[model samples]
Target: MTRPLALLALLVPVFTAAQPVAEAPVALDGTHQVDLVSEVNGHPYRLYIAPPEGYAADDTTRYPVLYILDGRRTFPAAVTARAFQDIYDGLDEVILVGIGNGEQTFDAWFSHRWRDYTPSANAATDSVVAVQFSQDPETVVSGGGPDFLRVLREEILPLVDSAYRTTGDRGLTGQSLGGLFAAYVLFEAPGLFQRVGINSPSLWWSDGETFATEVAFAEAHAALPAHVFLSVGSEEGRSMVPPMERLAEALRSRGYDGLTMDAVVFADETHTSVVPAMMSRTLRVLYGRSE
Candidate 1:
């Protein structure tokens, strides 16, 4: 099995990534890009800005910015999967900014994502299922998510807001570890984003009781009102589904005065296949435009 296949194999209900699926291709239609170098708390980050298709200086229109994790892959794929041209054919536009690795992604995202997403890394005690990527397999530098988030807020978000015509209505997206981070941000900083799209989050990574974190957050923040979309591939890892359902129910009980939580299980999508599927839905749900 390929490395990706090996990763997905750990997940059950297996929609194998080995097979091909039909998806429409994207045409650039004159892409505009700007490479930016920025810093947050003294750490430097690289940013790639993909302006709206058919962009014009005189348009002067403010658009919703989509902040995508795993930008090395997701940014281009999402731009195409969402059928960029078709979605913005008539309606307003959006800015696609791909934030790449800062020094090291595995260390940066893995360690920090856990710290930011999970209520506590010490919460897990189970041994029946092993959560891959839970520990720093090599460097022993883990749990720095709060710092990563600071990079986004202080460095990335401000750059996009000032450099592009932004409406301040941002959408955050991630898959697996990234998904966990997205959900974490939602509960911890409810007002930071208007919408969040999470795909195949490793809910069971911390423990079977990750829902407790959300429940606790709701108890503390009475007015947490943000739209949330959660998805896990039916064929994903063994622990993906049950925890997803648990989280949905937790949100239901917590009550978000204006919260909209959607949990999706794609029967034919494994952990790997679900990325594109999630991106497709995320575009429609957040942007209000579908191809």
Candidate 2:
């Protein structure tokens, strides 16, 4: 099925659902499940939005939102852990927004994530699962990092701002490959997000090139205005530490007057087991509440 070059041109469908359903909560905290849908350049998007523990309809209290990657799988656990923290800390009130595929999980998470997070399309990029899983060519979504951010800026952020009493201070988070992507976004769009929490980031991807770029950006720039929390499993892999260290060192060397960074190696956690604890700690660190 060799399609014509004209049809093969860049005319992505931008598969998107309508705005999320802010339905009445089954519980009083407005902690119900919601999904935000949007599109960029014809590519559809669906993000998970989890309201605060006691999301009162009439309280009119603005909350900080956490934009999570791989929401389909992580949302449930995050919700449970958040509930626990809310009880333990007695101050766990915030929104958890999980960003993932609407109906196409693979594309929403992997393909689209790679395109939007990585700074380069080079085949040598590491920490990325796209090259290992991508299948379709027409539906093959890639190399739209900036475009994806535009969708977040134009479509998603506006919807969040208008619908809820949001503080306009958002946090971005992810695990493994997703975590690496978070680092990419932090450097690429410094003004968009205020905090980023990356757990077990796949810095090994891209041949450790992201560090050099990040260093260059920090050196050339005047100031950084966001806080970064990067953690990794000590026993995960040997190749992960140096790059992570380099990222922190780069920030320090370049002088982060406004940046608050905490990079730790969790000795007892694995790549897959660090998300829950990291989420709790990251929430506390970024939002100023802890359990």
Candidate 3:
């Protein structure tokens, strides 16, 4: 049926307006990206920086910096989680920094993470990972965590500190392999971060060498002055849950002074699905304001 001329004209404009139009991408407010090449590790990294609401350049307030691993995926999640907590739970405001390898593809990012997160090289594990990803074992490089930590300490942290108004208080959080790196940092340089979140850490990495690191830390120090949140999914199976529980127990058994540790096993969440809950709870435990 043909419509009247006036009706057709009105409908035409509406339909035309409703059609899809290409527009410039909208960026998150108060967020920016910085590309950095680490002098310590010679690895290029992309940092996703998000300042707290009402942050101002001239403001005297210096916020704590929360460094998140796997920034390509976790940065947005961390930002959302923090924003929600800030609104509903009275969470303290802090700067969020996401450390990414600057890769755009999954395989490339995976390769970088595999190289950067492991503490020791294991040919067996490398073969297993390569098979899982359908790649050659020799191509999968493992163990550059010490150098990665050096990159953060000598390069990333210093850059972030100089670029922003930040306090000495720092928090670090990572999941899976990234979590393993966080644990490594905890034992190797506990003083670098005041708060840490180890979410579903791949403690199985390198024959559970992180356990040995923990032992070394215990031998060297009588006290651990840090707030640590350790969490895992109940459904993550033997590889994840038990080691996390064991680590928690071992840390508790030491009775380390000034150590505020909170460990939880989230019900029915899988390794991949537990991240949102892990990030949310980690923020609350690590950054919640005192009432």
Answer with 2 or 3, whichever has the higher TM-score.
3
lDDT of 3 by residue, 1-291 (tens): 456877888888887787676988656777889998888777799999999996897789899999999998888888988887777756888899999977888787888899888888787888888989987566688978889988999999999999999999999999999899999999889789999999999999878899998998899899888999999999999999999999999989999988989999999999999998998888888989877
Candidate 1 on 1-291: residue-level lDDT in tens?
Answer: 598888777874555646776887543544434444435434345554666675677887778888887765677777785465365463346777666554345656544344444434443332211255455444333344566777777777886787777897888988887887787788767789988987788786555545676778767777767778888888886788877777877887866688887778888788888787888777666776544
251-285 per-residue lDDT for model 2 (tens digits): 77776668888888877777777777777677766
RMSD of each: 11.6, 14.6, 2.6
In order, how many clashes per candidate?
7, 12, 0
TM-score, each model?
Answer: 0.74, 0.77, 0.92
1 or 2, greater by lDDT? 2
Best-performing candidate as measured by TM-score: 3
Better of 1 and 3 by lDDT: 3
Give the higher-TM-score candidate: 1 or 3.
Answer: 3
Best by lDDT: 3
